[model samples]
Target: MKYTSLFTVLLVLMTACGWSQNDKQNTKMNKLTDFEEYVILNKGTERPNTGLYNNHFEGGTYVCRKCEAPLYNSEDKFESHCGWPSFDDEINGAVKRKTDADGRRTEILCANCDAHLGHVFIGERLTAKNTRHCVNSVSMKFVPSLNGKEQKVVLAGGDFKGLQFFLAQIPGIVRTKAGFVGTGSEKPTYESVQSGEGNYVMAVEILYAPEKIAFDDVIRIFMEVHDPTTPNQQGTDMGSQYRSVIYYNTEAQKETAQEVIQELEAKDVKVTTTLEELPSFVEAAENYQDYYFRSAEGPKNHSYTKRF
Candidate 1:
């Protein structure tokens, strides 16, 4: 009897310890919003056309909202038009499906944390795979891949003095430097560029993380800070040195920049922004760097008319 009691006590202690460890591990993730908890933890469904990513077709990875683990890829996504983000495939072993409580549908859950994703349906013939992982937008976060790359875009739109300051404040931007590029010369000085030594322009090189920031956002901010519609001028600053142009680092950036320009045009906003491959970057002289920030009058009184 004594031996049996001792064994039973040890079993109870072990079970409690295991439960505590599991609980700790589960709470290690970032805290979810109330709505996210309702859908991800309670298996609730979002209404059609209301989710953040239902129409999003960006080239990136879809990660679990609760754990940020890789769940799906953009290439696997298809236009199911089902009011939810639909994927024809998932990362291998990244998702698990189980017979739902209704017994008529299979519920899909994240394989890593078992957080509810949505449902999986087969035999749909939507794609070659004929499978769809119908997922909730709130259950996942779209991570733009930018092809596992980071790059710098040099944009010239007249005086970069004030615009460069505002662009640097945007999120996901790694750094911003006032520079001269596309001048054909290896190291064009401010004096040389302004004097038409090359295809000189007052530009800013914006280095950013592709995953955290979309190129579209970068272009949008560029439009906001300066007059893209004007030719070779922003406000009173004129000449080819102040022309509106984007020097993209990669083909992807060039495509994105053009697409954004087209989108703006569709909205009846005339965009005279030029898109081209990035040229050699020559950092501006020491006095030109952080001009607005270091000035005695401060950012409120600056050269650029608009400030973000």
Candidate 2:
């Protein structure tokens, strides 16, 4: 006798949880049970604070139960405390939003199979993006990303404090690490870099999964969060250290960055962001690790507060 993996067993159990008795051969997706059908096939809402994924924090991809299309990543899930799983963002083109029956709330559905997931709300300000996709746990399944891709990109579009805040909130992104690059030195401290002792630029290392969130998505967010059109300036902060730059770690990333830049240029958006190969990333001082989250006066009073 052979034993199956825990993940395999979990998938079987989740599928069984939604397996229907009849009409299973007619549809492209797995037939949903009565409760799953209520929430996924028909527009229905689960009881608040009763969702399985609301408090579940694990590394995996949340896929639509109907068609199994990848919808949201675990990294995107946040503790909205709204009784359901809340995500600040979704995989590009994975979710579709429409006006609810009451014409007030925006209903969310799977783009691939049109399965009812839940609803999305804006202006919530629960996260940096100010958007939330409230979803029902029964409508989806969690597939662990056993070998998720991990890539690093260097971002510098003025105040890194703001960039760190936004990127940290984004789904598919790993721990937002603050550091320095492109200084032509082995390591540069915050004081040395700030005082022009090493000609280094203020930057942060964005670790992300390209599969879960497209590189273009990251670039788009980066462009929106800061004034890339400004040369070496972000609001009142003006210096070469604040220059908009993206240091790519791989040739593929470099190509993607160039392609995205050209697309923006075609639209007449003058992007002053530079594309450079990744350099030695020197970790910033302990004080600046997570300035936005650790701000004594709160993040609202910060210089980049207005951007978010």
Top candidate by TM-score: 2
Candidates' TM-scores? 0.48, 0.52
lDDT for model 2: 0.69
Clashing pairs in 2: 49-83
**How does residue 228 of candidate 2 score in lDDT?**
76
Q: Write the per-residue lDDT of candidate 2 for residues 161-202, one digit (tens) a residue.
A: 666755655556645667787656447776666655667788
* Residue-level lDDT tens digits of model 1 in 1-308: 00110000000000011211233255325455566677889898877755546655656688886776689988898889788889998999899999999999999998878889999999988889899999987687655644446677898887766667666555565556787876573577777776767776778887677676778777876776677888877776668888889898778888888887887788787788888787577778745554543332234312333312
Write down the worst ten-residue block by lDDT for model 2: 1-10
Which residue segments of model 1 deviate by more than 4 Å?
A: 1-149, 184-187, 195-197, 298-308
Off by over 4 Å in 2: 1-148, 184-187, 296-308
